[model samples]
Target: MLKVLIVDDDKNSREVIKLALERIYEVEVALNGVHALELMKKNSYDVVICDYVMNEVDGIEVLKKMRKSGNNAVFILITAFGSSDTAIKAIQEGAFEYLSKPFKMSKLKQILAEIEKSLSEKKKEEAVETNKDFEDEQIIADSPVFLEVLKQMARIASSDVPVLITGESGVGKEVVAKSIHKYSKRKKGPFVAVNCNAIPPSLLESELFGYEKGAFTGADKSKPGYFEQAQKGTLFLDEIGDLEFDLQVKLLRVLQENCVRRVGGMKDIKLDVRYIFATNVDLEQKVAEGKFRADLYYRLKVAEIRVPPLRERTEDIIPLANYFIKKYNFYNREIRLSQGAERLLLKYRFPGNVRELENIIRASLIKARYTGVIMPGDLGLKEEHIKELNREEILDALKKAGNNRKKAAEILGISRATFYRLLKKFSIE
Candidate 1:
């Protein structure tokens, strides 16, 4: 469970919040900001909810002190006496969220839920980064279709040529890129991965190409961008198809010239970097449509690898699901899929691919924590595909529901109307 520290001078406010959140979180309350800071010295908290007004030290001061101490807890500032400027200042100072006092408990719960998900995702990413041995062992390539892609990756790993990986979202393009980097001679150096579309276009140029001091309004000090940081290594630019047209030209120049000039620098900084780009978009179509530069497309596509979608590579689904189950085994539960659950997963078309499978497995584990065996219903395949359940399955559901149609529909993970249709199709009274 996540630990949360609530800092408020008012005893009623503190007790109310503690009562509301203690069930979901390991919560502790502080009498004031000063008390909160003292508690912080003894224990780490995932989140801090602090009232902006208090004696000895205010919430803003506590936040600054915590940040200065290298605490990365999500700080939520609440103030009954706050102006727009104060809210802005709190946010600018790195508070995760700022809200006025008298905020609804539901709203706070919603924010906390969002924070939980965000933190969970961050932890997953960090785990992937730090656990290389586990990752190498768990690479899902059971299907011949995907194995061929791996063979191609092996062929290209030693080569310095640019690589373009094309596939749908969540098709593991970045994973392939990382494998290439790991096997390459440049593996000793950095493997800097960046999503070209994730960063705002306005700031992306400086982020990719670095900047000199005094280059822009906030250029307080010279900073090396992604390209410079990836010197003597591979730079994986994911979603390169979504890159702004203007940056395409700059990137082409860098590839051709083998150097980069900081935003306000005079001299070009030469780099020995390999480039691997991935995109779900069809660059050929973009080129024909004049949205992408043909020259840049050709430059990036020295070797192209297209990863097949998950539905096409169904052979790897169960293995990948099991890998995710192990990856997110938070409670160390010996969770396994029931026969019905395995069949359901194999039959369903995973539109979101491997990522979706992982999410389903993680959630199913939560639902199956006590039983240690995931069932079909726990898998949460309540889509149109649930209709794939045959007459026998429908009859079983009806028996489970004691012949109540509505309850049977619920058991079958379908609407009552759809259940009626299924019953008619099967000639069941």
Candidate 2:
């Protein structure tokens, strides 16, 4: 629901406005500009309504202070004495809509409706702009490993090749996929991404191939899947190694034929999508273990790109850290990582890779909001964090188990003796 703040010293005026707007919005009341500012600091409001003839801080003064403080909420000044000059000034100073006192409820409702529609359109525009910014960033990398990957991506992005991206988890493979789509001839079209590891095998196929109306139980309506949505664009398949064997064959057929037949439907749909598959597993090893199909692996590896883990690219740490600090500084006005914090970040071997670095930076920024400068203590990385996992096997187990070691070993589908030996080797209790 839209929230509105009403600032008027006159109790009757506040009550009248509240009565009219309460059913439509979440209404908040403040007697003066000072009280309104305090409420704004603690929460966000969609619109602010203030009386023009207040004693200390008038409506114009309140609007000026709000603008100076970077408050983007829409403002509507209520004045008993309305003038063309005053309305012009309000518009120039970023007041969204101006209202004269003793106005009809219908007019107020109409104005509120217009403001809501405008805000909705603005939000949609902002979302598009933010996605464009992510495209611009494109996961900055110049390391030898990334450069080689970029070269491969550039080569395949222009073609209709089924390119597969192999890398460790959180190594920015999705970013690489997006970069390929952005630079490709399909840049004008949509780029769709789906996590194969996240969805179950039963749902994964439906998600990819889409479904016709009444295709299956709970399949209420006809829907276009990733392939249909990504027509003339790029379809990014993240964690492709996790796809079940049956779905693998179906996916392989779709890649080979450039057509897909939805589940419970006989008709085939031709797709003109560039496939960009990503996996954090060794496909060859998985094939040898009978977990992944060799034929499917070969097809996806027609064009390959591997993103190096964070530990392998230590040189990018400080630069990436500073980048995140500056990026987050927009939201948090006062935040900077100290030299000690930077050193601590660099020294740690980030097994969780770029994602972990981002989380650490976000956590530090929150800490900095309260303490001014982000220090080592703000990072929350002490001896306990170090002791948790200092060995590769234990760390690998933790990741496989979703950071739960005992469950990881249980599903290792590994023998107890071997699991204990591995744990001991890793000094994991």
Alpha-carbon lDDT, every model: 0.84, 0.76
lDDT of 1 by residue, 311-409 (tens): 889899887877887788664335666555666787788878777888899888765543355656678875765336689988998996699897576
Report the alpha-carbon TM-score of model 1 versus the true structure: 0.65
**Residue 212 error, candidate 2, Å:** 1.6
**Residue 203's C-alpha lDDT in candidate 2?**
88
The residue-by-residue lDDT of candidate 2 on 1-429, one tens digit each, is: 678999998898899999999999999999887788889889988889888878778888888888888786778888998899989887667676788877887998877765564344334332211222432344656566666677887787788777888888888889888988988899999999999878877788889899988988899998888899999888999989988889999988998888998877789999888889999889999999999999999989988887899878877776676567666654423455555456566667787888888788877765454223565556765332232323664566568558765555433333446567678886776
- Clashing pairs for predicted structure model 1, backbone only: none
> Candidates' TM-scores?
0.65, 0.59
Leading candidate by TM-score: 1
